[model samples]
Target: MRSQFLIGSRAPSIEMLTWICGKPVFALQRGTIYIVALFSTICPHCPKTIADLGQLHEKYGDTGVVAFGVAAMERAATADEAGARVDTWLNKELPNPTISIAFEHTGEMNKLWWVASGSYGVPTIFIVDRDNSIAYIGYPDTEDPALLERVLTKVMDGSWDNSAEAKKAHEKWLQGALVRRANVALSIKDFKTALSTIEELNEAIPDNPQFREAHIKVLLEMMHDFEAGWIVLAGLARDAIEKNDGDWLLAAMQQLFGSPYDYSCLPSAERFSMGKVLSERILTLCPQQDGISRAISYGAVARYFYESGEINRAVDSIEHALELVEGESLPDGEKQNYLAPLVQALAEYKGSEIPREFAEDPQNRS
Candidate 1:
């Protein structure tokens, strides 16, 4: 199903019920590159994505490039009705869009392009080369977000390598679809599906450690498979420890100590052993005298130490974090986001009431 729409495959035809602006395009024009932005009228925020296309249209229109914004997965009853609604909506959303747009009430365009390519959702973008081949298809703002711009420039300059481009685009394509599917599944509390999909995604994109953590999250927090999740996460923590990967180690520790998930379910021996390793690793990797990076790391490790009954270590860590927050590296105004949370943690660690001096919420302060 997806092979036919892979990079370098002939792009599907532009078939919409109503063409909003520019000459109605039914066939690919020779020697002209095309950029199509797919958006959903049903999505309140999809209008924002059109502006990105509009900017590009104005930027590249003179250079033999054409851009289109097609409304897909609309909620309106008829094609004409959807077209009319979209015209009014675009006028309201973008004020004056330079690119051509079309409306789709039937799901044919989505099925033909989005589903056929295994890409999902609105704001998905496609760049078609002059030869009418599907040069790229996936969400624009992701995994090497500059990929669209890079691919567009390469294709326009007659230097696109399908094998190299597809390697990047295809991975993001699978990731985007699986992420959407995982979200949909999680919304319905279909933990089984969410776990499997995230696991598949994690395996497919090993460079992204967050996906691996997400897989563990779904396993332990959503599916309540504590032992299974711990096994996977512990391996990551061990690797992070060995490699001096502070960021990955921090994420692993947060999964153990941070909330919305019940940490009590974690086995006692495994919990502290992991926390001890992570906390010690973080101490070495994130020196206390640095910027927001250290401040964040210190704050997280503080919680682990505080819970481990090392009150002095926890207090010192939080204090250093608080001091780092006030450093010149962080703007006085921007400090509140970190300050508010750290202040609360400080009061809790000290087993005292939060003083009125620091009682105000950062959000309210702003």
Candidate 2:
């Protein structure tokens, strides 16, 4: 569904049965510009978005711009469960509470706002003007923070919805929302719906790598059309190499090596051959100093080597990946997440059991 509340449309009422730190909040105070951030506590990116909102609130609170967070209820089984999760996240991850936090218990809030607006993911921000009209609905984080700040300023000044830039931003957001909806369809295994949605997106925005990636994923993994999928993958690889686009090359590698797709169904030799080519291209385009991308590329190449019975080459590749991880600066948890898997793979390659110290609890990582 496309968003019902467009740039000039009236925002849905904020009145809902919301729990704030285990207490009920009946309504948002009227007569102020409100930035309602719809997010999920479990989303890896939500914390940073929430922090950004908090900063926005701090900067504009006195100017009558209020930022509030509403955690979605999709993940939790009950209202109480959802409230508890929000409370924990607020306390641990976002302690200052610069912005009011609310836990959406019933799905009503989402149906009224998120679904009505065609937003399918967390961290979507909706701006409510002084008159309670919707001024903006899009991502909180942009490549240009100053541009977002200027938009927010205009939002508070009652000029954003009428601006040409607002129209452009809304159009861009709608396009992204369509892509997100297609991804949702793919996640639910509605391959036909996803296929059609992606095709529509591709036609609308021709040669978009994002749409192409989704199309290839559906073809190869869901439809089991290896012939068609390989053609797209090979073309993408060649295009990425020719353009020297490390990001697209990495995406191509993931299509072949990433989880959820059972590549064992394909001919091992051909799969390995494709993987080797993609990996070499990725390494050539993406330097070793690029850290995470390089590490991931190495891991993909290592997996290809291991499956091809080149045990020593696999060990070498994984070792180099692990060495890069060790030298890089990453959070302890994130470092553990990458290191544990690589170490486990190394142990398996060497015909030894995974060391207890290197084994990670899957439940703890996310």
Candidate 3:
């Protein structure tokens, strides 16, 4: 099913049934305008947005503005599962009446609200009029009191034109829907769907640099198709080098070692060569005298050796990096941060011999 939602069109009536203080409430009533915030309970940014919606609900509930939060738990299947997620979130930290409208979707409400309500990112806010037409779509961060007031005023008076600007806004919102679907697919390791979504988006928005570049990274990580990913990275790197863009170099390095996926599969020799080049370039740019940069460079080197099956070298490199962190005159939390994982990995491996410095005692501080 196509998940794209367009604004300035008929808003689908989604049944929102969730609980508050053990009492269930229905979200839709025939004559009331509703502002809904679609969110995920686990999303790091969702709570703050939910808090803002609570404030809006508190101020507007009696007069006509009704706000609700809709969330679909990651593994939710039945109404019971959805309700359990809501209950858990409420029990822990997020408890708001606005969260009372979440329920499991059977695809009916998913199609209706996912796009029109700007569900691309959690904390997406939608202002729907009494007629169920979306009147405003935006992020809470971008929303102003005046904007909310104007929408509410128009919806209450029944005089909104649903302006030309709303149509344009809806189109822009729909474009975000495609990207959002691609991101969710990538998150779940659904490579083919993610690639297809990005490819279509790339075709539709040829001039957009952000879309093209993001798709390239998504293709590499999600598909595990490094050859194509590397080719684009190399091309982009070369272009950036010609332009002397340090930002692009950092971005290229990030794509190389940023994830848990294997770049070492490129061939030990190639991995070592690429690592050496990038490490030298990064050090020349930032020089790891401090804990953070040192840790980052150290991580790149350690990964390079580990991927190449040079466990001894990896151990030595990590030790040296940890030593640098420990030797710092100032206290930097990353020293312990970087060393703890390296120590754990080195300690756990039965096949590889730990380095001399770490072998004497596994708990030895760097």
Between which residue pairs do clashes occur in model 2? 3-117
Per-prediction TM-score to the true structure, in the order listed: 0.70, 0.55, 0.47
- Residue-wise lDDT of candidate 2 within 1-366, one digit each (tens)? 333345557777667656584233355456888888888877888888878888898899889878878886545677778778788887888887667788677788888888878876778888878777777888755577666678888977767777898877876776776677787887798888887777777666555676678878888878988777777767766666566666776766667666466676656666567777777776675574478767877887777678778899989989999998999899888888888888988998998989887777644755
Q: Over 4 Å off in model 1, which ranges?
A: 1-103, 115-124, 128-133, 138-177, 329-333, 356-366
Clash totals for all models, in order? 0, 1, 0
lDDT of 1 by residue, 148-218 (tens): 77778888887775557667767867777778888989999999988888878877777676887888888
lDDT of each: 0.78, 0.75, 0.61
Give candidate 3 misplaced runs (Cα > 4 Å).
1-110, 115-124, 128-189, 198-227, 239-251, 254-277, 287-290, 301-320, 328-336, 340-352, 355-366
lDDT for model 1 comes to: 0.78
TM-score-based ranking:
1, 2, 3
Which of the numbered candidates is closest to the native, going by highest lDDT? 1
Model 2: weakest 10-residue lDDT segment is 21-30
Task: For residues 1-366, write the lDDT of model 3, one tens digit per residue.
Answer: 343354555666655445444224464565777777677778778777777677777777788767767774335677676667767886676654543456554545555666445465666777777776666676654545455556556667775546564555555665677788888888898888887877777665544445656766775666667777667656554544444444554555555555555666444454456555765565566553466566556655566556557778777766766676666665444445555566655554335665555454334555
Measured by C-alpha RMSD in angstroms, how accurate is candidate 3? 9.5
Evaluated at residue 211, the lDDT of candidate 1 is: 87
**lDDT of model number 3:** 0.61
Error of 1 at 27 (Å): 6.7
Q: Which candidate leads in TM-score?
A: 1
